[model samples]
Target chain A: MANGIIEKVKEQATSVWEKVHGSQVAESILRPGSPFKKGYSDTPRNRSYVIMNNVLYHLHPVKVKRHGVRLSYTLCLGGISFFLFILLTITGIFLMFYYAPTAEAAYSDVAALSTSVAFGSLVRNMHRWGAHFMVLSVFLHMSRVFYHGAYKPPREFNWVVGVILLLLTLLLSFTGYLLPWDQLALWAVTVGTNMAGFVPVFGGQVKFLLLGSVEVTADTILRWYVLHVLFFPFIIVIFMAVHFWRVRKDGGISGPL
Target chain B: MSDIPEHLLRRSAEAKAKALGIPVEDVLAEMTGEAAPTPMDIGEQPKVETVVAPDPATPAAVPVAEPETPSQEPTPPAPVMAASSADAGDVDYDAAATKAGMPASLLKRSVEAKAKASGASPASVLAEMLGEEVPAAPPAASAPPPAEPAPVEEITESVAEVVEIPIVEPAAAASVAAEPPAASRSGGATAVAARPLAQPEAVPEGVRTQRLLTVVKANAIQQVKSEPTDKVNTWPHLMIMEFAALLAVTAVLIVLSVILQAPLLESANFNATPNPSKAPWYFLGLQELLSYFDPQIAGVTVPTIIGLVGFMAIPYVDRNPSTKPSDRKFAIFMYTFFMMGAATLTIFGVLFRGPGFNFTYPWADGIFFDDLKDWVNF
Candidate 1:
């Protein structure tokens, strides 16, 4: 009697799943080539459709050169850098929810994250470390491209775009460093921006613009906060789009060499 | 014609436009009968007929319409054998036949059969079979007296002369065939009968002579210079590896996050400044340079000129196209030198500099960098 009930339940469960998967709503949500779509099969053409039909996978081509897929060739440094940026963005958004950007509340809010908020400390840690990792990975990716002579010929423009992206990565990291509103964050930024005051003619003006004052203060924190979270990310995303596009346009990854 | 959907007609027009190198709107206009058919439109009928009916006699009849090129009008009677010898010099008939996926003997026999039926020289018949221009027909006056077989050697020898025939203008051929003189001048009764097939009037209105779909030449729309590469699909092959890399990075980041809490020191105090205040690690190298040179040079010039402008210029400056390490030794060496120099400066700034920005080994002075202060306790 128990076995028969279990079998009946099993059949009911299967039918329910089939109904849900094959429903009009599900079909509309899952595009023709989506792996999550009902009746998807593992075929070579379907494999191509998997990339071609999906929005996120649209970043990559339907196929890539065999050698380009090997971990050793690229060391996956560029992909890691991009992935780290995404990780940082996620963690940064979580950090933003509990913390305020003003100098008066910034430190206390950050302190409260560890003491009061759930998983706040962990997310903050991830954000901090992920930013640092992104900078390192971007620099390493640039080095790898250089060593392989991937910046040659048709790839020259892409290399320039990549260099701009690296600079943006550093800018993004630097801006976020000042947001913690601690002694370390304050002094570190002071030392860094003080260097900007040494520029030839517009040194003082540049430093003034960056800080929103003659020196780092409450206004400077808010200014850097907006830059770190919104402005720089928006700019970086645009450049990254061009960078990935140019990679495919300039003939995918460079070569076996 | 009216029953076809607008989109289907538009699509067919697009294919015809692309093949004929005309504007799609023009083709569409012609297809809709909104614009009168040009001479070019009438010209396609015979080519369509050739494709539809591969009968041997049809091709022989087809070329008789070529009064458009007066140079092809002179047909010398019984010059079939003589013209064969002159025209068949350059092309290797056997090699061409093999490449076309037929035996040399089979191609010759077919040519012989076509020549006999059409009363054209065997060389011209061979040219037609190979999709090449048939050599100028021997004079209509010399049309080979019924079924006289030409020698094989003469036929194969005369392919060279066919190269001199100007590309046939189908429009001109269609118009020329409409005249009685040209139709009568065709070599045989079969040729005269085939002339009407090329006439635009004979085709039923709205009958699709060509299919709407065609394989558009890849080069026509985009530059496809690349050779077939050894490739794998991006789904399981590349995406799987990408996912693995992503998971590995996530795992490492999560572990690091759990083990080491991010640094959040005492709130900012304007009065008390740390002894050896430093920039974030990435800017450390520039700060390190601040100690050695004037702030203008290290802080302003170096970062902007060498860091930004100079790095961006590397590709444009290094004209060495070869990606091989052996071939570009100097480029590789220069980049390696810069990398090593930057690493040395950054390392010096991060670990070696202590209180008062003075040189002090981390082992002796205890580490001064506050970012890593929690993780690296001396």
Candidate 2:
């Protein structure tokens, strides 16, 4: 049978891997209980140990309900959204090196980065597209949860947490939108902050807090740059820790009930 | 157009008072004589009678029919049968009712009334309804026994039962095909048995509705599963999916970034505003709203308040315990409508607005990409 051949090939391949990776360094790094090392036997117990022992793998549980993993149900949207966020963070950090967030320098810096710096456009593009993707994937993730009724009961608090995360993602994108400081960035932010000025009692105060002036300026660019680079990302990291922790505590992604 | 039977009203009042943590005497004292004739005020009384009565005509017996009841009478009795079968016998009906979703007060009155009317002991009636045993009905009902004494152990057992229900249901999580047969509760045992297990003929080609019973059973047998019985490990399952997503996203973005460069149209000049200056795509939804309302409501008040209220109200408003989408049609529909409205508004703002902010389709001139028209022309 094809399965028998596959099993034989897998056995051979694993033994070969073990032989190649069986040095003293490998052994030190991958002890019997190490997440990097698989146990002698390919049993469920060992597989579980593989997940539980590793610092990175420990985030997930040893056993998973089959329903929770169904691709049709989840569409892996939340995972994709999280992945996109990570990608954005990495690319955004690189973009920050070349970007100068000031009224005079912002536009020229972006133009130079794209035209002169090697792979600078590529990095910028990845960050830009990743932001857009995270927004979309987060929205789709919310929709998936809604459609699946995964937001019901015990998981209700997590759903609210997810909504807050979604808002944070939007804010992240909106703040970053102005860092380019071109005609598009300037006008788009002008229209956006104008909306904040419509808030009732403390509208003007909030607008001042955001723009640091009656209009978008050097100060506004600097404020948005700090938020996009540091302040918002820090808040997001804290919220994400809670969000994933709650997902685990609230019984792991709410299978069919 | 008659008053609720004085005895039935008294029992319902006592049950409600108990549920509300109020004294029964205070509840009874509060009701005036003429209030009884207004069946509208005593709506809870008829619901209790309906649950208790095995017959569909039970509401008529409660004397609160008000000539508008017969049409809607059949609906409640079916659930009574389901309530008994789903959590019958040694399982406390009151506790099971709460779990199987016959609320405490409603099931308490129903179980008591049904037992009294049948002249059989409550436990025996419950057992009989479960199709386990058929206790003979007593000939006479001249004297009824007082309610059973509740021991400490029994109270604790019921509490445990209530706590355990939620955990058990998700573990016994049936497949889509298995659900319909179980959920069609009114369709008796024979009917359920007659239905094919995984009706291949019913399912469309290329789609298999196979039950994951083997996986569930394997998980059930193991004390220490490699992963949580109810969850998949994130490393391989989730990590792989996310990695694939990242690759696909990066590839697409690469192609896009290579083909079309990001726009950088000169420096910001305060004197020169783009004719149809607009917000980003995400805030385009709000910009669209501004067209219909005053800036305060559309931009600040409505958006802020609606987001807060909508997110917070989900748990409180939707008390439906089931998570199956089929069971939650209205919730799905309303959410879909809200999302679709936002999408429509964003699309309108992003693609339709032109110079002077007037309506213009994507094909029209004076749009964002109008300057690139010569290069883009096919």
Model 2 chain B is weakest, by summed lDDT over 10 consecutive residues, at B43-52
> Candidate 2 clashing pairs?
A62-B226, A62-B227, A63-B226, A63-B227, A63-B228, A64-B227, A64-B231, A64-B232, A65-B230, A65-B231
lDDT score for residue B78 of model 2:
21
Q: Which stretches of candidate 2 lie over 4 Å from their true place?
A: A1-20, A31-41, B1-239, B369-378
- Model 1 Cα lDDT, one tens digit per residue, B69-173: 322222222222333442554435686586567888888777777577656667655544543222344333322112222332332222121111122343444
Q: Write one digit per residue (lDDT tens) for candidate 2, span B84-155.
A: 443344547665465446576776676677668655456544433432111222211111111122332322
Docking class of 1: medium
For TM-score, the strongest prediction is 1
